[model samples]
Target: MVVLFVVAASVFGLSSEGVRDAVDDVGPLAPLVFIAFSAALTVACVPGPLLAGAAGLLFGTALGTPTAIASATLGATAAALISRRFGASALDELSGRRVTALQDWIAARGFLAVLYARILPAVPYNLVNYAAGLTRVPLAVFAAATAVGCAPRAFAYVALGGSLDDLGSPEAIVAFSVLIGMALVGLLFAARDVRAARAARREG
Candidate 1:
């Protein structure tokens, strides 16, 4: 693992400009090459946002958004499967009511559950990737939910990165608006849930 990371780092470099240059040098195959590296690096714990930002810098918003989404979904799916296979087994041995409850909740709600978590801004993306594997949610459902739920933010983030040098650009404006809108929506959902929970407690 360490050797692989070192090799990739040497080949791609750690800077936005460097990775962009290296991948771009691949000519027509650049997007595929970027996707491969992005997926591998993400599995190694590299932040998805960094990759998405790099995508925008490398390919602009239109191309970068889809590229980032594919890379993130592929990588996140891999990480979740890894955790499910290894981590889930270990969790199974430990056994706790809380664990069961979480697993069941995720399993029962399936796509929507994963979707809601993915849509929420404060939720950590990478953590969800690994943790989802431990639950009973089907693999296909997890991947689909991840792609759909994350698409909006992926576009917004890519646009933001692409517009770093030109914040006045239309892409930047749309990106900022989407991000803020998502944040507000997440807050509203959180408040509603809180109220519901409080009401339930009172009734109980």
Candidate 2:
């Protein structure tokens, strides 16, 4: 599915706008096409916010959030596994201080590490997938964390996107609130992780 999407995306130059056009081209298979294209773009580390907006433009908030979550999880898992298979050995050879420190931190925290990464808006979603691939975290743990941790933000983004025309709508207001809440919670997690990392270094 990913490969197929990639090929179609290559032909269409997939973006949020492009996705809509592509979906229009395939009336009955729009749902599958959306997920496939989104996942492919994600695995390629080529698109982000635009894809969520496309989800809203196509399916509205109710259906868009679930589809976005599904695509994101699938794409993240595929990217991580690809990196694990092909890039881990290469990355493990480099022991740069920052690299080693992050590896140790993530390896120590496992699922929580991924959950934190997913929620923290500052963290790049695609980068974490690749980085986690190089770590000892299990694939199951990675996928589960990605799904759960990303849900809130996914819903928020899709809802906001769906309500783009009516920024003052109830749905838009609620979506903004959700984004703000997630950002605050993510910051708390980040602060805790930083403190823990410092303490661990001192212990070692």
TM-score to true structure, per model: 0.86, 0.77
Cα lDDT tens digits, model 1, 30-109, are 77888999999878989777677778767778789999999989988999999998888889789799889888977999
| Root-mean-square deviation (CA) per prediction | 5.6, 6.7
Give the winner by lDDT.
Answer: 1
lDDT (Cα) of model 2? 0.79
Total clashes in model 1, counting residue pairs 3 or more apart in sequence or in different chains: 0
Candidate 1 residue spans exceeding 4 A from truth: 1-24
What does candidate 2 score on TM?
0.77
lDDT, residue 136, candidate 2: 80
